[model samples]
Target: MNIIIDTVVKEYDNVTIDIDGYVPIDIKLVDSKGNPPLYWRVGDGSKSLLELAVLPENGFLSAITLVMMDANSIHKVGNNQVELSCEESGLPIVNLDLWKDSANNDFSQRFIDNFNCDMQVYISEDTILIKIIESDNVNWIHCGGGFYLGLNEEKNITHLLINSLTQVDITNFTESVC
Candidate 1:
């Protein structure tokens, strides 16, 4: 693919987006073994895994989240003179789930700025659509709020945008959780 997360970050070793409830979501763009700290956390300072709390903010959300992580695992978004000068590459999509109170779930609805594949191609020409790879968890459902006895298959939080669309399935991830 011609995309990997975004553009400014032209290279990376690996990329992993950890979506957990406690932290909500933590995007780690591991560029080098000891690239240096670009964010903050309570841990050692060996320097890998850039954690961008909020830079590529997205106002859109849906049952599925769209991101392009290529073989290089490096991607950048935006071309604005001002925006291009930013340090962070991307942020949690619709991650406004926090610092704004919680009670809803959302996913891809519109082309979100700052946090999508290079808009120049994906949204502009509308060519080379991003593909959903296997075993890549890409969905999150808040399921109204409150609590539950256990994570039912329906709300086990095990969903992915398969076939390029948001769909639920009974996978090992769900089975182990429930």
Candidate 2:
């Protein structure tokens, strides 16, 4: 099994990470020691977890919301991209860009330029995970006079974890998010 981890730093404390291969079996939000954060409960990936007012650490704001994808649900669109869709409606929820360029990949950079947050990736023999860290410094643009959640930032944050039961699970198990 092989694993690869990538990190990206963007403006306004926004970050996005793209993990290739592997599939996830479970997801959770834990502290630096891997213990569950106080007053936080795991939820299905249908809504925003940040709205619950999960407090910040030190002076920075952060949240971990997991999107569990059945391994059979992912389809490769190209050599550098994968698409995950809603099983019931077949609507796309996330598009992973894995484009590899010279020296640097444009996928993470493009996400940073677009979202402006810090991102981390965790890949193991059987799981590919993405962690997005956002801070209060981010400038969110509210559209239609606050009719929407706001733009210029990736809100309703969710981490896409591939289910390990899929045929593609091959990496050695590794514990992330501690």
Best-performing candidate as measured by lDDT: 2
Name the regions of candidate 2 deviating beyond 4 angstroms. Answer: 1-67, 81-178
Model 1 C-alpha RMSD to native: 19.5
Can you write out model 1's per-residue Cα lDDT over 1-178, one digit (the tens) per residue? 1112212222332344333322322334322232121221111112111122222233221122222222233222232111111232222132332323222222321122223222211111111122222223233222111110111122221121111111122121122222
User: How many backbone collisions does model 2 have?
Assistant: 11
| Model 2 error, position 140 (Å) | 13
lDDT of 2 by residue, 1-178 (tens): 0011121112122222222233223222222233222222223233212111122222112233333332332333212122333212111111122112212523333221212323344454444444334323222211111011111134333343443322233232221111
TM per prediction: 0.20, 0.24
- Candidate 1: misplaced stretches above 4 Å? 1-9, 40-178
